[model samples]
Target chain A: MSCIIERLAIVGVGLIGGSFARALRQAGAVRHVVGIGRSRANLEHALSQGIVDEISFNATEGVAGAQLVFISIPVCSISAMVGAIAPSLAPGCIVTDGGSVKAEIVRECEKLIPEGCHFVGGHPIAGTENSGASASFATLYQGKRCILTPTERTDREAYETVARLWRVAGANVCSMDPERHDRILAEISHLPHAVAYALVHAVGTADAEGENVLSYSAGGFRDFTRIASSDPVMWRDIALMNRRALLASIDGFSASLAELRRRIDSGDSPGLAEFFTIAKQFRDGIL
Target chain B: MSCIIERLAIVGVGLIGGSFARALRQAGAVRHVVGIGRSRANLEHALSQGIVDEISFNATEGVAGAQLVFISIPVCSISAMVGAIAPSLAPGCIVTDGGSVKAEIVRECEKLIPEGCHFVGGHPIAGTENSGASASFATLYQGKRCILTPTERTDREAYETVARLWRVAGANVCSMDPERHDRILAEISHLPHAVAYALVHAVGTADAEGENVLSYSAGGFRDFTRIASSDPVMWRDIALMNRRALLASIDGFSASLAELRRRIDSGDSPGLAEFFTIAKQFRDGIL
Candidate 1:
């Protein structure tokens, strides 16, 4: 479908936000794109790079005439942004977010949202290490999955509108329970970051040999370092917000680790072999 | 030096071994590169692809008159091959290996080594998921470190020869104690593999809703799965042979994981923030 929406407004002109605008426009999914952000420089940059047809620092004016509004701010600011634009949303406008955590965002917005506006939670699982408008490319969302978590109060029309937009941008849309989404991602995404960060410290910390360990950290440690190099503030907020689920994943990992330790201490070669072999089987199934 | 060595022998035609041959040939490090393997098809393929100047299925025949011998077979088979070649190695021949663990191979070879053949354990800190000769690339060693663990018994001339050859092939060479090498790599390399495998199986062994969890395994779970997709036999042998150091690394990781769990359970916001912030600092040091 060409020009599924007449206007698409993206609030936050960072990597994810700029990428969505660029991809939609290049794919002909939206006729006109509007960019909104707290940073005047970012908005100007987005407009100059053709990521948006219009630029507005004022949140209300940005969404005034838009059919689709995407709140692409960091997780910590999702609630405030939802509240800021809730009062001025165009009639029957659809609102979705690209935040990592959904339950909290959904819960905060559900109670204060304006009537007739659909608030469907969305997270497009497409990104790169680079950030900002210059780093964004038009094909960033091709073949990636976008998850839509709609609540009971969410309008069906709003959900479909967001799904259609994602589909036109070359994303496969899937539905999930918000709570389950948070928990599953805690194990897969958040825990890896936490573990990688800890491992980085463990290697770089004050070993008697100084940076000898860190100097030789290129083996497998380099990969861990990249994941650990993510934005500190973003990861800090994720760990604090998803504390419960992150804890559950850590517990599961600890139990598995403890079992390994017991076998090692007892010199159980057969047991260790069995454990590693089974683990190999499970990972093999994924690929 | 346009060409340093007149002849070089690589004992296995796997990714690392084949890549070493390719890089050496591409850089004119060695004039004649010989590949030795048990698989007839692999030996023929290596010859046809110009990965080696010659192919020999017999270990003794492979090392005869060769100035440099590289043992690139699996860890378990390292000792037997060393024994087979020790009796036939040319006088003043220098030998090195691409194995992950250093101490075991050093210990096994030190017992049966003949005079004038020196064993300097080497670990090239590079590779990909793909294996075998066809997957080999010439730039595999570019900008990577190659750690050499040489004991007091190692001949100075032999050590320098190995270092110079690795340097010629585009690797930064450094020296470390074999025992220390095992411990350091256990944390940076071995334990990560173990944890990746365990995380995969941990999700698999979860309760009745495990299928749903597996389906959503694309996020960061895919990263763990990618690492765990490593050769099962190779990993199993590593876990079994390097039992002492691998287990110790697991203990260290377990402690860190437990601390994360405790902070999450108690809702210790400061603790979580401090932990993540400290990790960020360490990760930044690497970059």
Candidate 2:
């Protein structure tokens, strides 16, 4: 395959960003790669690991002549990074992001693109609890789903280019509106994270003879709380950035939990069994 | 190792009961094993699989000359099983059960012990979603915790014999008050199951443009809902059997979730971050 892009720039060279750069380099899809991050140590590590050809501390200077600028940062910082890099982008430079939430970033960053530049919202539904440059690998996105949200004003060529980049990284790309993407993610991702955090907090705060009940937690509890061990700041930003949809999801979850609680309290054995049956069927049907 | 018991009678030859019989038989700790259950097919399967030397449909008749009677059934039926086998148990037989909840079972079953027999509540902290005689294995109790709850009236010799049986099955035996056992288990086991079920029910009921959201569920969601795929009748019986502790845990979890909701609604970024940090720390500390 021919080189898809002559120059590629990635801001926030952490797990997601470093993984993207490594995968593209291994695939020989890009000629030059530049990494930008706030931490000097992480940038140095990325350089030594051959994840990028060059490094920059400033987003504006990083994308000076790049044909693609991938803003792989926390959800909260994506908007600011886009604004910072807008003035220095080359003509027709396609800008994309790797963040969990889509609507807010797309809404806030679309108008900041330069006249000849393009912006597309992208999210790769793949990661581990570990972060930083050392934790990234080339196969991080293999067999994963990458959702791209494009508005009516989005340039079709730019959107296709971003989708191709994800495909090169071994991801299956799907397209949907920003609003719908955020709503679907809220139900599947954000709501489950919230439930896990709440569960841990509840068990931690319970008065159970000052004993550490976690030592006795079985395989099921371990599996259930695995997501609760995610990065704190990243999840906090996601919970706030998608506040409206997340709140709606929480309401729906609360209502369902209340119904289960009511059934248990009323000694309604049949109702409880039916509730569990429905949940089990849905759980078993999960792909 | 010397044989621990001359004869072992297993009531309800399903997952737990069959597993106990198989594990003991593998250890060469029992001379004869009699399996009893309502399902003729399960009993026949257990006999064919070498999980038991003989099969019977009547619990009372099965324990006639047995020196050890192991009752493995749902928590709800332990009381009646105890009453049925009390009259048939030999003078020096040791009776024990494998049930999730201890207080209720111990309370009702202790009184039914015959004049010279002993009853000890045993709970092995091991199982999978799959149940039945076919799922039984010799190593099911290896490296697992088996909690024995003994009352004041319990015979010391019988309790030690039960503990040794669990040890022979490759389990670490621990003793605690029945009430304390129920309380701790409610937090670690029952509460997590309830949360998983509620989460599944919540997402299953969401309105997402008629799309099956579970089809889009990623690895995290799959791990979170695994326990929700458990046996519905089993969980329902557990919920009703340990109602008080489960209810308290539900209330505590609601409070925690409510606090998280308030923070998200107010856009308290730092507070949300702290909540996730605490949860992550606790989750990481889990063994």
Candidate 3:
């Protein structure tokens, strides 16, 4: 495939940004990749690792003259990044983000977007607990889902361009309303993380005698708590940024758990069995 | 590596019983294996697959002259099996069970154990979502932990013999009080299963429009809900047999989750981050 953009500026080059850059480079979809971040050492490392063609410490200067700008940062910092780079972007520059929570970013960044430039809220549902440029690879987004939240005011040409970029990188692109995206993600992603964190805390704190109960954990506990080992700051920002939807998800899950608890307390073996049977059917249909 | 027992009888030829028989046969630990079950097809399948040397539909007749008896069935049915075989077992025969919950089994079976015979409670901390004889394998118990719960009245020689049986099958043998074993297992194993079931049901039931939300779940959701696909009947029995400890675990988990919900509702980003950091640290320390 031919290069889709003359210059691609990636702000906050970590796992998501670094992986996008690498994937774009491998697909020959971007001619030059410019990385922008606060840490000079990380930017230098990204340059040395060949994930980015160049590195810059200034977001405004880094985004100048770039036809495509990808903001890959925490959900809390995305709005600030948009505000910082809005003044320096070219008139026709297309700006997109890799934020987990979409509604806040779309609401805040859409208002600050400069005239003639396009801003589309995007989220790539592909990542691991590991972060940093060194943890990135070219095939990270292969066969994964990338959601684009484009409004009526979004430039159709810009949306197509961003969608094509993700497609070239081997991702299935789908579009939805920003609010709907956040609500769905709350149920699928954020709620699971909350449950994982709570589970680990419950078991860890239960060891009053420091018995190290985790040592006896088998495959089930290990797999269930794997997400609890994710990045704390990122999850914290996610939980806060999507607070309303996340709170609703917690309420829903709490109700289900309460029902299960009541059944167990009543010694209603048939009810418990029926609950598990339905859960098993649903779980088997997931994939 | 020679045959450790002259004859062994497996009262339930399912995953656990069949695997135990296969592992013992592979290790040359038992000269003859007798398979007994209600399903004649499963017994025939076990016999054809070489998992057992003989097949019998009668538990009492199958265990009449055996030196070792292993009851691998649901927790609720274990006491009945002991009663059925108690009248026909030979003297000095060592009998053990592979049940998830131990307290109830030990408390009930110890009374019906014939004089000169021994009953020890055993739980093998190894299994998959699959069951039946077709899923049995010789390496299922290799490198896994097999816990034995013995009380003050347990025969020293019989306990040593059961421990040796599992050790010969390449398992790490450990002993604990029956109540203590049930408590620890409730925290690590049973609670995780409960949480998984609730999570799946929460998401599965939330799709009021039948949007098939689970089709969009990522790796985290998949791994977190893996245990939800486990057998419903077995888990139902476990929930009822170990009700008190599981209820306590559910209460602890609910408290942790409620605290997290409060922090999310208050938009306490720092508190949420601290919670995740502690959870990550605990999860990382698990093994």
Candidate 4:
């Protein structure tokens, strides 16, 4: 598993990319790691913090001669970054990502990548409330799931390389079709963000004429607020890119919430208890 | 602060009572602490672990010489415990509680307390997911808020004694009327539990009909399930007893959720972003 990716280039030096760089270096998975992002201060910060071997403010310079390239920017800006690095990527370079949704990136890569190069859509289901390079750490991906979406035409060698890189980063990689990946994540990841954001919205603007006690919400609402505190641009892009699946999740959640309200109103105590118990057991089963 | 309560009796020696006992002892506010509960095993366990100076199986016998009695049972059974202990309470004894909702318990005390005793309603707004006496620690209430509701007829001396006890228990005590207390708590505490229970209910029940991937709910859904994992009987009683305020909170939450869905469906990106930003700022202010 040593140096699975000979020289890995991260195209965005944010939390995910910086964390990937740190993890790869700490795990000794690559000979060299280079980071590219928009800010000079962040690049300098990442370099001083040993997040990368070299810092490239330009996308093409960073991707040059790299065996594996990880596009770890906001989902909305991924297309422009891919187009910028398309001409400079090595002939057999394996390109992947750390985006929340997979389909849009996979589709964008299809039209942008050269015929000989490889493209495997990936999303490591891990992170924290904090963002940016300084917040990154080597153990960020430990024991987390990383999902890869590879088409039939995608090179098997390229997929294996991507999977192994994630493994070294302490991830368990699973392969799925792009469509299924989006749908599955819509239920598990995207929908939760949307619902959390919506709950915060409701609590904040609720009773505008009143004291608006969202300030005092400490228990569950605090957690909802923390989840909603994620990078706004990143989340907006995820919601818009995975629109269909995310909408369907909202519908599912709405139905369930409405049913719960009905049960409470009807004083169906046993039904409520059963509902809570089943959910508790389901959560207990998860890591 | 030394031995303000010379002999303190704590009924239902679970997480709350056990923590209270530990905090009182650590602060040197009670010279002797006695544990009481229906479960003999719990009483024996509490005594063995040194959580209390002594243990008593009979609720009446536990409060015999004690100056202060804390009813820490589940909300539904607090009234019955009050009735059972009224005959045995020493003259001028101060009775308070650790229930979530305060109105019903206050009403119950007014109906059942002995003529010479005083009852003040209380709620300590602090806890964790874990329960039982073993989970208790002396610092459980540090920097947390505690609400005290005293009726017009409540003895000033009794009310002050209860407030002083919570202060020694490492809580910031605030006084409020019983009805107002219920309304405020419904929004801050009870509604979050209902929403969490409902969210989990939706996801768990869906798995019965389909390939419900509650397992993959890694990010925001984790928070909902964590809160939903609270004891079912406790939450049920809170929801039933604080019905009106909880119902209002539910309605408020639904209105906000509906507005979010409408904005998303209409492609109102700006509106959605504005909602998200405002919510984020509001939450940031609170945290």
- On TM-score, who's better, 1 or 4? 4
A174: Cα error in model 1, Å: 1.5
Docking class of 4: medium
Score candidate 2 by lDDT.
Answer: 0.90
- lDDT for residue A102 in candidate 3, whole number 0-100: 94
Query: What DockQ, on C-alphas, does every prediction get?
Result: 0.47, 0.83, 0.86, 0.55
Looking at model 1, residue B159 earns an lDDT score of 90
In the range A152-232, model 4's lDDT, one tens digit per residue, is 768899888888888888988888888878887877777667767776666666535475566556555576457778777
What are the chain B TM-scores of all models? 0.94, 0.97, 0.98, 0.96
Instruction: Return the DockQ of model 3.
Output: 0.86
TM-score of each: 0.89, 0.97, 0.98, 0.93
TM-score of chain A of each: 0.93, 0.97, 0.98, 0.94
CAPRI-wise, candidate 3 is high
Which runs of model 3 end up more than 4 angstroms from their true locations? Answer: none
Candidate 2 RMSD computed on C-alpha atoms after optimal superposition onto the true structure: 1.6
lDDT for each residue of candidate 3 in A112-168, tens digit (9 for 90 to 100)? 999999998899999888888888888989999999999988999999999999988
Q: Point out the higher-scoring one by lDDT: 2 or 4.
A: 2
- Runs of candidate 4 exceeding 4 Å displacement: A207-212, A219-221, B209-212, B219-221
Model number with the top lDDT: 3
lDDT by residue (tens digit), candidate 2, A1-287? 68999999989888899999998889999999999888899999999999999999988898999999998888998998898888899999999999999998999999888898999999998888788999899999999999999999999999999999999999999989999889999999999999999999888776445866777777778888899988899999999999999999999999988999998899899999999999998888874
